[model samples]
Structure formats: C-alpha cells, structure tokens
Target: MPKLRLKESLAGLKKIKININFKKKEKQMPIPPPPPKPIPRGLKIIEKYPLYEPFSHVVIVQNPKTGEHQYILDELQLDPLERGVYDRILEILLAEIESPKEEILDPRKFFAESAKKIVDKYRISLGWLPDVSWYKILYHAERDLVGFGKIDPLMRDPNIEDISCDGVNKPVYVWHRNYESIETNLQFPADEILDNTVVKL
Candidate 1:
C-alpha cells in the first residue's frame, strides 16, 4: 500500500512540472512592435491679411504636424469690369509713387509711410473712399513697392524650392518641403496675369 502511494505522488509531481514548462514556453514567445504611426497632411493658418474687401485675402499656412509652410493665392472674386477698375487704380498708384530716389534706409517704414500718404491723397484729391481698409492698402502697396506683389508671399516661403506655371487657366506648381512637388490651388486665368507674375518674380 505504501509503494502505491509513492507512485501516485511521483505522477502528480510530473504533472506539475509539465504545467510549469508550458507556462515558461508561452512567456518566451516574442511580441511584435506596434505599427508605425501615419503622417499628418492637414494645413493650418499661421497668419492672414486682407487683400481686397469681402473677396480676396493673403494667408500664411502650414502643415500642423510637420511645421511645413504652404503658399496660398487668394484672389479677388469680381466681375471683369470691377477687376479692371481695381487693376487700373493699382497701376496708377504704382506709377505715381515712382522709385525711391536713394537707397531706402528702412524699407518697411518707408513703404508704410508712402502707403499712408497714397491713401490720404486718394481721399483728399480724388474724393475717393477706397473700398479696402487702410491696412489692406498698406499691404498691397508695400508688396508692390518693396516686395514682389502677388508672389511676394511665395518668394518668402523657405520651404518652397521652386515655383512654376504651365500656362493660363492652369494651377501653379510648387516644390514643397515635405510633399516634394504639388499643385497649388492658385492659378493664372490669363496669359497677361502669368506674364505679370513672372515679371514680379
């Protein structure tokens, strides 16, 4: 009877050892690393300026996750006649201002002062209440005088390596920081506009 009891005890011990080994094997199995995270493509507005009242604007945008700048061309939505009038007004302003007689010491201050004078002149001489705000006037005039006008913001973006346009009614292309090359929403509707933009560049 004692011998039978010993044999039964040995069988129970073997069962316990087998269970422990199984648990050890399960723990030793390798676990996979989590899948790589996806890159974000959404853009956010970093800054903005009103270009024309109720219609056009200039905005500085960036990819929120990547911190990459994206150039935007916000155009005025107007009838051909109204747009023509505005263009003529802009041309007149540019012509009257003339080029600086000497090397400007402080371009920003000079442009700001000049823009204010121009706006004041329009109000007093022409009895014109420019539809745009004073700030908008300053932005446009300064861009034309000291910067590249419509393409100034694009030129200022460090992330854009190159800019190109195929022709009229085609979207402008830009070599972006993260996106490589991509088509921008901005487009030139006419050959003259494209030529003008190229001249500014």
Candidate 2:
C-alpha cells in the first residue's frame, strides 16, 4: 500500500511540472512593430553655402509647401587655434558692421571679403601660418558671424521647431518634424561654453 501511495505522489509531481512548463510557453511577450521609414517629400535646393571647407556645406532647401529649411551636411571640425581665429574675425566684422555707416553692406558679401582680407593680413603679420586651410577658416568665420553662429544650422531646420539642452555634456533635444522629440548629436560640454553659444542666438 505504501509503495502504491508513493507512486501516486510521484505522478502528481510530474503533472505539476508539466502544468508549469505549459504556463511558461503561454507567457511570452508579443513582437514589437518595426520603425517607420522616412516619408518622401518634394524638396528644392534653394542655395548652398560652404561652411568650414569644401567637404561640408550649409544648404538652404525649400519644401513643396514653400517652407525653407537649413541643413549642415558633413561638418568640418576645427582645431582650437582655428576656432580662436574665427571668433576674432567675427568680432572684428560685427564691430565694423555696427559702426555708424550710411549704408550696410550685404552680410554675405561683407563676410566673404572680410574673411579673405583678415586671414591674409593676419598670416603676414604673424610671419608664420599654421598648417591649416585658410579658405576653411574663413568660410566658418563667415557662416558663424554673418549667417548664424553655432546653432545656425539647427535654427534653420524646418523639421526642428524647438531646441533645448538639459545641461553640460548632455545631447541637445529637438522637436523633429518626423520623429517628435529626440536627442541630437550636438552638445556643448561646458556650461560657460553653452551659455556663450546661446548668447550668440
């Protein structure tokens, strides 16, 4: 009788194990849906201005509904000295433009010409120029000063309606036209630097 009872207990345990296995199979999560593809929109290239060099450009685009957008394609990263040179030239140009004058020169022409002249004069005065591309330096200076500073490209993006950053070392977030709110690649790693950049806008 005891052996028969033991056999019945073992059989009950086996049935419980089978029931748990079936429950586990029933509890799997459903597969998530795939992300949406980029929507096709008719875009017109209105104008393209060179940014830091020939490698990258600041493009002005018009959409089908007659909306303008700005895009920076393949940005040119600059060294510290080159950055300083750009800032210096921008300051000088802004001061010159602000000075009381009968007529204000077109920013596009003024910046392009000023950059060429300033860079040449600077190199001659220093007696030694860095192993850097002068045209690139001038191009960036003109764009930042005459057009838009650090956030010029971001501001021009019609897709991005609002821009915000939480803190230093944090990626800036934008309200993208397609993606909604998303983090951007742009960051100002330091608070002071971020403050200065915002001041420009």
Candidate 3:
C-alpha cells in the first residue's frame, strides 16, 4: 500500500512537470508585438501630400474604429511673435497697396512682390526672423491678400468641389471628389474672425 501511494504521488508530480514544460515552450514561441495606438481620437494617417510647397500640406486620415476618412490641413505653425510681426506687416502693406496703372495680369506675383518689399523694409525692426517664420508669414500674407485666407488650402484642392460652414465654432465640411463630404479642421472660434473672413470672401 505504501509503494502504491508513492507511485501515485510521483505520477502526479510528473504530470505537473509536463504542464510546466508546455508553458515554457509556449513562451519560447516568437510573439508579434501589438500595433501602436493611434493618437488624437484614433486617427491613423494613410496619405499625405503637399498643396502649397514648403509651407502647407494635407493629410488623409482614417479612424480605425469607424473607417471614416478625413482631410486635415497641415501648415507651418507660427508662434505668437511671428504672428505679431506678420500682422504688423500685413497692416502696413494693406494701407500702402496702390491700384495698378493697368490690368494686373499676374495678381499672385504682384502680391508676392509687395509682401517681400514690406518684409524687407521691416527686417531690421522685426529682428531676425527664422526662415520657417519668413515662409509662413509670406504664405499667410499672400494667401489672405491674393487667395482665400484660412480656407486657401481647401480652395486650391482640385479634388474638393464644395465647402460649407453653418456658423461660428463649427467645422467646415468639404465635398471631395473621391471621399464625398469630409469635415475639415477649419472653424471660426470668434465672431469677429468669421466676419472678417466673410468680408474677404
């Protein structure tokens, strides 16, 4: 009877060892790492392209859970100091702009030249502006003066056909040729800005 009980205990111990070995083998198998999480509400960028060279770009993103595509404008982000300088330059340029003596054939080039002159004139007083800031400032000045301001990227996109905005603090939706209606990052945070944009439009 003692021998039988010892044999039974040894058999049970052997079974336990076999189970432990199985677990060890499982751990040895190469396990693929889990995919990294998407940020800012699970948005995964699928495609990116430049609309305006160097300064402005657009990204196509998909929501993993919803699989909805969105268009996001990515432009050079300007700090407060750069914005202040741009604002000052824009004000002076607007005041100094003169009507062309003849029909302006190349309006974009004309506005660009005017902006460059103002930037050069105030270069000393504005201190040393970084190259990125210079491009960004010039882009905004040209965009507002010659093209649409905040919605210039959307306006320039050949794929987009229509743009709609209900009111202030609302996301502007655009009709894309391929994606249909897509909500954009553009919105008027204040009434004054919206009014100004409307006047410009």
Identify the candidate with maximal lDDT. 3
- Tens-digit per-residue lDDT, 1-201, candidate 3: 011000011111110000001111111112222222233667888877666555556878888899888888876656799889888877787777664666666666677777678778888888887766777777777777665567766666767777777777888777777788888777868665555555444
At residue 76, candidate 3 shows an lDDT of: 61
Residue 178 displacement (Å), model 2 = 2.1
C-alpha lDDT of all candidate models, in order: 0.48, 0.47, 0.63
Better-scoring candidate (TM-score), 2 or 3: 3
Model 1 over residues 47-133: C-alpha lDDT tens digits?
654433233444557776766665465643334544444455566666665546566656556656665676566654434444443
Please give each candidate's TM-score. 0.51, 0.49, 0.74
Candidate 2: tens digits of C-alpha lDDT, residues 71-137: 3244555667666666665565555443223334454554466556656666665344454445556
Where is model 2 more than 4 Å wrong at Cα?
1-74, 79-108, 127-132, 143-148
- The number of clashing residue pairs in each candidate reads 0, 0, 0
Give candidate 3's error at residue 3 in angstroms: 99
Clashing pairs in 2: none
Cα deviation of 31, candidate 2, in Å: 47
Q: How accurate is candidate 3 locally (lDDT)?
A: 0.63
- Which scores greater on TM-score, model 1 or model 2? 1
